[model samples]
Target: MYEDGEYGRGLVPYLSDAMMNIGTKVTYQTVIYPSASDDWILAELYKLKTMQTRVFVVHALPDLASRLFKKVNEVGMMDEGYVWFITEGLTSQLHNLDHKEDLMQGVIGVKSFIRNSGKLFDFKKRWKREFRSLYPDDDETQLDTSGIRLYDTVFGLAMALEKTQKEKGDSAMDSEGTRALKGGSMLLQSIRNFRFDGLSGDFNICHGQLQSSAYEIVNIIGTGEKTIGFWSPKNGILKMLDNETKGIKPVMWPGDSPVIPKGWEIPVSNKNMLRVGVRIGGFDQFIDADIDPETHQVTMTGFCVDVFKAVVDALPYALKFEFVRFVSSDDKRPAGTFDDLVFNLSIGGYDAVVGDITILAYRSDRVAFTLPYTEAGVSLVVPIKDERKSAWIFLKPLEKELWITTGAFFIYTGLVVWVIEHRVNKEFRGAPHKQVGMLLYNSFSTLVYSHSKCLCTLLHIILSHMLFVWFIIC
Candidate 1:
């Protein structure tokens, strides 16, 4: 973690509490540097890279984050699996970061939700117009959320002061420049309860803190950021406005990959590689670990080993690890069961165990397991037969029950039409072929509104008369 002193005070504790509540053991390291100290920032980034910390939670001014990321990108470490999570302080300044967009690409940040309303849009338009007219030479003069919030706070305080003066009568005049207000506590209380709609949405306060409607999860794309989702205290993470909607827009992740990142991996600080335990008994084809006689180095290669390496590499951090053969000193036979290898992790014999280890309830109680990457239980592999070809493939999208229900609805509609119009209608009283065609047309037309010219005229008259009767009844 790298941040300036002022912003770090509030942000650090909140992030620490969040991590602790989720049972994550974090090794917190803080780097305090001035906002414009390039040398200091470069040194810190090098230290972080050495520590193998791929995910950095940056709590600083927007300029500092831009400088730090520029240095990081220059080092060629800004590719896949690196993550930078920033606080609202930096995100609010995104408009001014047009020049540093490449440095900040793939960054994730949080901001207070500001709904797009007509009133808000109008305010933005006027603000921009006035800004352009006043400072025509300045390129970065856009209003941000913080500025709006500050504007609201000043107005709220003014209203509270006015109310306090009315309640305190003439005594409020004496406290204007004499240390504090005569009813300052009362004025503060009034401000806390103030509620109204402002340019940034609902201007409200609760328990001396501004109530946040939601936290927008933004992803930095090209030159600006896009809202990929939102997190509300009431509804948790949502892709859309609410739970009923599809989701937020898709995000372009690091390296332009569309997949969501797995946020962590083993650290490779201190030039220490991970001590991996691999079993070599029952599943030789899945995994095989042995010592190279010529090189005297441990050699491990198999399906399971390949999968483990891929997972480690896919983590949003850099990790250095080497597989160690989990066998007895005798260099013969096998060790114990899969349970023994897992127990080794607890006993400090290995940092992690990788093999055909089945995740059972008993094993889970002893050690934690990640989400399984492969299918469990048995799978039968069958040969493909190229004998059959049919036109029924078009119906495969619908389920069997759905097809039956649809056919039943069509038949029922035809029967009901025949019964209703067969007696008096000339269209229904026809030859066998003509009767079938008329019945099919009537059945399908009921699904869609279609009718002959004569029937259409009669239906329009009936609808108009019904509407007239309904209007009179109302």
Candidate 2:
């Protein structure tokens, strides 16, 4: 029997009815804490164990199985439980996680989508094993069942487990105890011979795939080297494994080549090498691979097959391209150009400016970029706290202590002139003594000067008057 929807709000009465009908004595508790934090989840689980409840029908979201497993470890319990019902995602989703080897080891069940239909006892046994291994203090009497999203987790696990067991014994029974339940050995063996299709595709519990085949193996690479795992693209799918009895020639790819049928040839006369443009600083990724015009032997350079594959995947399969060359210093740097104004960027030349191109000194030829591609105007570098909030980090080192000290001296010089003339700014103004000391700063700030006659005159008048007044007052 089963109940649905949000636990207490929708199915409490139904669950009670099912328990009563099943004649099973059950104990329950309403222990509440911050049901949110992972810490709370673990602490509560341990506390629940101490409470003598055999089964916990948790009412949380289905995705909390991983959390529950991790928290259970935090609570100092290992591999103890009779049964667990988790509220989680579809069984297929769980299987996918497992396939990726990303399955959280401790989680044993799901409740969200009850995907399997089979006998209950067998599933209960396996689930009991899984739970005990995860939370060992758990036993049959404890029936320590708990899930984050309790309902979905339990439903999904129960369904998948039941369906799986039924499938094991699902085949038609044979006489002479061949398919009988006597340890189910013969029956399991028969089932092993049974290649039944489940939600995860076709699988045989008995005769393993490639079990009967023997083949010659060779060491293509003499020493230890990178190995590529060959996976059947159609492994475990129904549409696959149902092919008519036939033979297809084994495909081989040559050494250092990604092209399939490793030694195949293409009938061609002259080979043509082509060049294409990628974004700046991506030339290393677009090597035109070498191929024999006769044999189609695709030989790539040191360690770039995946990169090649990615580029190949991006383009259409019908079209073929090969990588052949790597960039050299000559390609990267410019030797001669159109004029001093125009800098050459490898394949082309353009007008140049100071600091217009990024070159590794001798290694690269400077290229002129367009006014828009590069900043057109002189950079008005505002203070970091002001307009430079989004300035590039590369420019930060350029504004280091040396430049700041030089600029500071210039600033101090200007400030001293301003102060001596009583035209000093409020921000820099101090008493006469401080002004005198800062006037010592004047020598360093050679460029902190007035470029206009009006400013110069004002500065001179203030300085002249202050000198006269200071001498007279002293």
Q: Pick the candidate with the highest TM-score.
A: 1
Q: What is each predicted model's overall lDDT from 0 to 1? A: 0.74, 0.39
Report the lDDT of model 2 for residue 115: 23
Candidate 1 lDDT, 400-469, residue by residue in tens: 8876766676566666666656675777887988878876776556534544422334444543453454
Model 2 TM-score?
A: 0.20
lDDT of 2 by residue, 359-439 (tens): 344434444233333355776877556545655855665657756765564465456575544453442357977765556
When superposed on Cα atoms, how far off is each prediction in RMSD? 22.0, 28.2
In model 1, the runs with Cα more than 4 Å from the true position are: 129-137, 175-180, 242-249, 264-474
Model 2 scores a C-alpha lDDT of: 0.39
Among these predictions, the greatest lDDT belongs to 1
Candidate 1: residue 371 Cα off by (Å): 18
Q: Give the TM-score of candidate 1.
A: 0.60
